[model samples]
Target: SWLLQVGPEGYIVLPSAGTLEVAGRTLADVRLDVLHRLSALFRGVNIDVRLGRPRTFRIYLTGQVKAPGALQVTGSPRVSDILNSAALQDNASRRHIQVVHPDGSRELTDVERFVRIGDQSMNPWLRDGDVLQVPVANEFVWAEGAFGRPGQIELGLNDSLLTLFRLAGDPLPAAEVGNVLMLHWKDPFKPDSTWLRLDDVYRGTTNPPLRDGDRIYVYYIPQYHLQHEATVVGEVERPGTYPIAEGRNRISDLVKAAHGFLPTADLTSIRVHRLNPGAGEKDPELDRLLRLSRDQLTASEYVKLTTKLSSLREDYRIDWARLQESPKDLDLLLKDGDVVRVERLVPSIRIDGEVRHPGILTFQRGLRIQDYVQQAGGFTDRAWASRIRVTRVVTGQTLPARNVRALDPGDFVWIPERPDKTAWDDSREILTALAQVATVLIAIKSVK
Candidate 1:
């Protein structure tokens, strides 16, 4: 019989054929080192290991082993000793026994199976130099870092090694402290969800759970104020500024604010001028002056002018019958925040009976009879319109009006409704009367 065993003194071997006995400490240490190294090779292989009471187990050794089987171990016997003991009991193949580990790992061994050795039970996954680990039952405490998070930690009965991380990078521009966010997997226990305020986080008051795959997110907040308002000018009772409520600052609103247009307002010829953007003050003023002077530009030209003004302020536009027409027809919308202006056309009387084409005349400062007659389309053929009869409405008096007679804004002149006769008798009489009056005035002036 061949005997294989290791005691306090070391390994002792009894040879199979010869009565030769071998004993040595170095030999035993080397044997143990080899066994441990072999175990490491199978570190992660799955092995059916029964953690029995004290020192017993019904272990299944399989996968990667030539002869896989189940065996009952007892009395602090190592796996190596179990295989060797099985060899002594049956015709077990010594080369078939192997070590298997948790990670589907395995290792082949050629050492004699039937051997009695004492040290400690081998952890097939740990190498000879590797420290053997005993799992110390830990209390279910809050664990953090790479392992457990802040809210729920797993406390070991003794101590443990865990990896951890920290808050990094610069704070984003919009991130608010009150609602700092963590975009992570939803906790199954808290379906309602949870969030942490920045104050709590900064003060370390709240220990929000930060698991392995957790990330923090930051967001921004919104802001609001009053945006825009307008002014009224020209032909109004009380032209001034007023508050512009939302969706209420239109042309009609401006007119209403200004107490409506005055009685002298030219409903058909109303003009609204606005400051033109990209146009210098001098240029816009000059343009307006030119339009006022010419007064006969096409609607297109007027539209262009309005567009120029609109560019400066979107609220400026013509606020009369013209505005009712299309913008192409020189009408435009009044923009909010614009100054509204109304211009009153000059008022004057018309002359007709003996004029070329009795037309309306415009009144100017200090306008005389000759100027008014000339502006009223001049005199007709063989008609003495210049020899006018000025009647006073209040006194009902007729004055012998002359060419240089000064007229008021609403005064009238009768060109003596020409008499229809074969001879020019009445016409001559009217002219002679006017001539006599002119001569008298000249004589009086000469005396003075």
Candidate 2:
């Protein structure tokens, strides 16, 4: 043997046995062939051979490939490894890549199968001096509605509806499989549609062949995935989520379904928190007015600001006592995601800020704002008495004491300490109250 080694050209020169082609062939297969030829020449002794280093060579990449030309790869690479080096265009055919061998025989590889289904068989090892022809993809199909991965997919020549659906992931539970809409273009100018039963296709039924630019829409069943439920907690007998028919279910109906309120249920201050209330588009006029100081606002703008604030989603409270008095006018229609919190009876009013003794006072139906303020040691000398506000605990509605005549049991009477507070400070305080109370929309008009 003439100092044999696996050269760049991938062959070994034997003095008497001649040359042998080894590149792209399996190392184990090449080892067997080498040993067989050499064994004939050198007999009566055991022959041992092992690969010292992996072989690397250049492979030609042409057609529908980015940076098309010879791409250098090393060490017994597969079709996928070479593909990684030669980035193919989006229009390149991933399902029918031709790997043309040096001897002119070619093998078809499916990169899509290897990627989507993890089918290793579809990805074959590369041969040296092989030419990869990444043809332009011509077929395409689309899938949408009630599908996990709903989008357009590159199609192969023999790909069927089943193949497209399989690549899209399993249909959602709400998918109306029997009525899956299939739209295709029979006439070049117009499109036609038909329904296919996907369940049958999954079975023994022949999967329909897909045409170019076909669309499959798997629609969802009506109300199949919808959940219309609300929560009832606190002093309610059953504190859990219950389904409601929305418009048909009233506050009383929901309460009755919860096995009525508990004995401690505060009938005078039952609160209903509508979780998903629609917040309308931002009002630029209202926004501009709010940013200005109270003195900067015109009389007409002040009126506008007050009117806009009133139209906002209010703090909703269902007084069982008031509803019982006038059921027709007071009964509220329950909505989805409404939280009916039946608080334990606490016949006490909270008197906070600027009060001599800020604390809870006994609730009396006849007591006015002044009456409660007097019981809580009255306002301090620094108190902004005109700006004193009563915040409805259930609805966070803070109003001037003059606007409120009699106070309820779960009410917060805040007496502000007189200050040269900026509009930003008052606005920030009002925003804090809104977040904490859930729907508090008190006007911050005391800008100094």
- Find the candidate with the highest lDDT and give its number: 2
Best by TM-score: 2
User: 166-247 in candidate 1: lDDT tens per residue?
Assistant: 2122233344557654544467343233565655654557655444334444445442234445677778888887666645
Ten consecutive residues with minimal summed lDDT in candidate 1? 156-165
Each candidate's lDDT (Cα)?
A: 0.48, 0.82
Each prediction's total of clashing residue pairs, residues at least 3 apart in sequence or on different chains, is 22, 0
lDDT of 2 by residue, 1-448 (tens): 2346776677877556888988668778977987899889989978766766665778999988898899788887788876752588867888789999999998888887677767777688887789999888877899989887889888875878888887787588888868888898897779998878978879848478888888999999888957788788899888888988878888888888889988888887888877534446688888998998999999998999888877775347788988999988888888888888888988889999998999988898887888878988888889999899889776678999888877777899999999877999999999997786653333343331
